[model samples]
Target: MSGPRIDPSLYRERDRIPIRRAILSVSDKTGLVELGQALAAAGVELVSTGSTAALLQEAGVPVTEVASVTGFPESLDGRVKTLHPAVHGGLLADLRLEDHERQLDDLGIRAFELAVVNLYPFAETRASGAPAAEVIEQIDIGGPAMVRAAAKNHANVAVVVSPDGYDGIRRALAEGGTTLEQRRALAAAAFGHTASYDRQVADWLAKETGERDRVLRVEATLAAPLRYGENSHQQASLYTFAEGRGIAQAEQLAGKEMSYNNYVDADAAVRAAYDFERPAVAIIKHANPCGVAVASAKTVDPIASAHIRAHECDPVSAFGGVIAANRTVTLRMAEQVADVFTEVLVAPDFESDALAVLSRKKNLRILRLPADYRREGWEFRQISGGVLLQTADSFDAERGSAQHDSSGWRLVSGEEVDDATRADLEFAWRACRAVKSNAILLADGGASVGVGMGQVNRVDSCHLAVSRAGKRARGSVAASDAFFPFSDGLQVLLDAGVRAVVQPGGSVRDEEVIDAAKRAGVPMYFTGERHFYH
Candidate 1:
């Protein structure tokens, strides 16, 4: 007839868990000694296993071994350590429930206030190419289970999965106890750590067995939240995996926080820059290259000349484009970069004085990257209710060599091109791969003087490229990502003074197109390779 009376001591708001006892188990020993010494000084009891207990004891920190706490020796090559009822009871018992507290007391199990656990280095082991048996053994079962239990009951138990959390733990210890909010954050971090660990394990297993299920598992950690996506109305954030590359791992030296568009445009520009070995500059806008230029060997200042040549290609369109250089930025180059209305600038390195000069623009995002940074393995694209994964695009340096026989270029025109024209043809062909479909690029004097991309018809792209090139098109070479379906597209370039053309020629009317090029006295080479970007 009456509701059960509740114990006031069992339920309270805004209570901090007092650190009476903690379980410490980790494979990475970074900062472990300092943390154990601090916990011992605070009069908190620490229970550890194997090396952890021995290290703490040797450091003169009072730590109890797990065998003593559970009254059982570790078995199965130490795999069964910390899996006892005593450990789980201490971690999962709810202090706020009278029934839970009574059960713990009846069993003589002490409640653990905190748990520090870092999983085995499975990623490192896999990367090292160890034997399958050895790699599988490094996958920890007990660590994730313990951490998950502590995280699930974070209301009374604090869990730390990595040494990165040691500082916060120490600060909370100094303040006498961990706040509820702090405990919640630590729990979230612990869950993330465990999730990544499991994802990596799944990936390794899939690779080992040559999985036919095609089940995909991608693990990513949050890098930062952007102000907005491509538009202010949309929301977006950046992510990095355990193995990050390119802009995801780049170091930001100065300027405002990078936006969604900045990241996309910067990545595109940087990828384009590495396609060339010479000192080169690429200006990108709306995920397409507005202009790209490589420094001439004879130029007095290679970097400055590259920037000037690239900027001169389409000065109006380059207003707010992102700029990327493969080499370090000198003071002179920085001065040139500052003169433009650039949204972001990325390079391998920058001079101190150059950085000082560029810092004048407060909104310009500056990032430093390695000269050879690029993505590896698979790339993914998400669609409605599904996902697509494929190999990443890479520029093959051997494609340019004559001995490779990669493309099977055929002469369908006036005569073979000169060495300089051949070089320009190869350069423009590589740059065109990164542009959208129906793309055309003009290269001459070690610069991309003009680019036309995202066109519905091939003829229109040719006209757009010729217009952008202007006087530079007089002696420049052009590249097409695919075969020309009709002869009209070739005629447009011939009218615009294009001297030579390189295309992946496989059209049904290929003879007609070659006849048109021959009629116009412009040499055309068929690469027998097609690169399409949607």
Candidate 2:
């Protein structure tokens, strides 16, 4: 069936719509008084609801209460005030039609040329750990409805949804009215604001009822536009979530602006460094860890020692790599880093003296982690026709359990070592998770000696690790992110004089791998959990 059509002459083509009247309602009172006074000075009639009316009157701006226009008191705890025809009729009216104008005059309804609204803080209320009832009450009904009505009729009305738009609106009013182009832009932003608000509310309710898969609503605002993406030809920009601090929200203290590659490497370095409880440092290149190390028992200037040890694992790869430290960057660590050509350095903070020393390098990007920074929420990867989502990889389940502690791991071969060697094995297991699979990491004295990552096969990864370690591979403990599918990979490490090994041990050839370690008189432990970072 054909849809109903209207004559084109019935629609108005307005270049500018004068603000003869407006409805002001906001949960946030920022710039409210100033806006009200400006409207009064322009001889614009103001119709406001509840607290908005009272606040405008207090500021000595003439105003009419919504109750006066609706001819009924705000009932049901003020929820029914703006739902009446007197309010919506004005916002949704087609002023270009003579029939609509006659009906408005007969019903004592006046058309509104503008609407200033901001919804209740549903996202902030829920994030504050408020009770379910309290948070639910913050879900705005009238505000979004009014906003949608005004925005839909934006040909004759301008809607402002944020305080940041106040100055622009004021300037437009001073120039006689808002142009159709300006109104269209404001309408677009209004719809986006409401969409994000509804998404937040819907997502929270889904979680409350244990129906997380019911909907997936992602909202973000552009933080900045980069020069390019991974390559100069591709376009890229950074976007930040409404709440929470992450790489996008981190404060850049010095150096050049971050690039697409810099954020990726910086985030990987942070994940690798913060995986340990002790002071730790990680150096990353191309989203793969080149070096990772934790503090040793006998280290003075523990963080500095960790940086030096991490860098020594693969000094050549560490060049131009991004670095992350779990603790504050001190002068001792900064001095050592100043010698290396690094792309980015991220830490919780930097000591004053440390900043003074590192600021000399003009092109090195330095980022300070946000307060209470956390890596949580689902990780997303895009494919050709779909997206893959999973909970962020974390050690919460294995944090203090047998999986992270060597005492709880199943010893498949050889005798157990002392405290120091056990510490090395634990650090190796955790650090290997940050490497790309097929991955192998070798560590001694709580520091990585070599890392093999992003290889096609486990045997190749083993060779890469041993070759990187050189003589340091002797007596070093090795960790495989996943089980060695065959004995050949295990033999490579065993032949390299590796004294001990840790792996998930789920492959069908686990028995053969254990037998290989047993023949070499090396301790082999199974974590039963594999971390494959593709």
Candidate 3:
């Protein structure tokens, strides 16, 4: 009987020739020495370029230089080394193609069965705050070329682009060489590697050139798949952009898969946590701050303050809310948090004991994010047909005084404001920025007593806010999203015993409103700018 007929397309001739040819060129030479040693032990010929060849040779692994393979020396500061046809032809040619085989034979070029290339550290170089000249110099030209070539011909060539893939490639080569499936997977990884590297370069260039009309390259990694979106039937996934800091990158130390609502509330809590300078905790629900408090550094019990404030605001709303803190969570903190039925807890760090205690509640999501989270650069919002982009609202804490300046236009009449009352007015002004449109905030001292947000009418919001404050509304300062149109709203607040008020001074009846405050003896200051949050 004749020998079994073998299909030509089934495998490359090199599958019969054995794994002996390997090309390695990388800007990151991590694990290159060990990888080269493994290939050498397998009797593979190592072809390399520049510092890679030097490193391999230094490690006693024989390496044939790219200059030897191309018959042309590297020039123009190593930029012209691997761009030659000899290097690319070896990588891109299909061993299965008759024409490709013929061309290689006629050119006296040896096909490279394996290509290992990693691009220059463009992201790292740019991150160092170096000059543009230094950054431009580090951009890789030939490395990507070799990688693309190998990846394009993945049917016959194996491409490895990451140090993490070194051991896998080594193991495969050691075990009868890489299979076609392995080659295809490596090829996909190689393309992804090059694409991300190019994106970094593109984004940097765009920033340098101020090209807003240019295509926006948003590269993000999926953090998790949400259980559901706004509704149970809706599907959702969380993708974190590269620039975001805070809970976007937080690692889940424990808990069930986060839902869409959980992520939204967590973000609100984290933002509030970042806003406060001292050790603080914020409990957020339905994308609104429910309760927030500053902790004494000596005691540093954010959990207690958060719980008490939550109950004060509305204990029912606090249930299943997200909690965030700017400091490490302790056993005491965890115990207090456990008392409330919270959906998630986010902190900078958590003690081992705290983690153990919190672990008992298996369904609660816990996240540990990096501290010092702050918004940077631009803010983007998606509308029905287009994206709206703007610089993030200014968080310039130093730009304004915490003390109210009576020299400014006063909308309220007859109110003699003391220093303490003035401080509360300033506090209420800052609090207003975080509330929704037509919002009103009532605060006594540094803590928020009542918050009315997302109301259609300004006066109604003031009434609701004052009602929420209850007895605390008395002697507290009130802030309006816009100037009071009529003295009726001022009369309502004064009836509630609100001692001071702050609002934007753009109303036509500003004089009437100032007289109302003056008549009510409630000190009122008007900031020139309106802070209306839609």
- Listed in order, each prediction's TM-score against the native is 0.91, 0.94, 0.87
Local distance difference test, per candidate? 0.87, 0.91, 0.78
Query: What TM-score would you give candidate 1 relative to the actual structure?
Result: 0.91
Tens-digit lDDT track of model 2 for 309-420: 9999999999999999999999999999999999999999999999988999998999999978888567888899887889777665544445755656888999987787
- Candidate 1, lDDT over the whole model: 0.87
The candidate that achieves the highest TM-score relative to the unseen native structure: 2
Instruction: Pull out the clashing pairs in model 2.
Output: none
Greater-TM-score candidate between 1 and 3: 1
Candidate 2: 10-residue stretch with minimal lDDT: 396-405
Question: Candidate 3, which segments miss by more than 4 Å at Cα?
Answer: 1-19, 179-182, 296-307, 397-419, 481-491, 530-534
- Provide the global lDDT of candidate 3 against the true structure: 0.78
- Backbone clash total for model 3 is 12
Better of 2 and 3 by lDDT: 2
lDDT of 2 at 313: 95
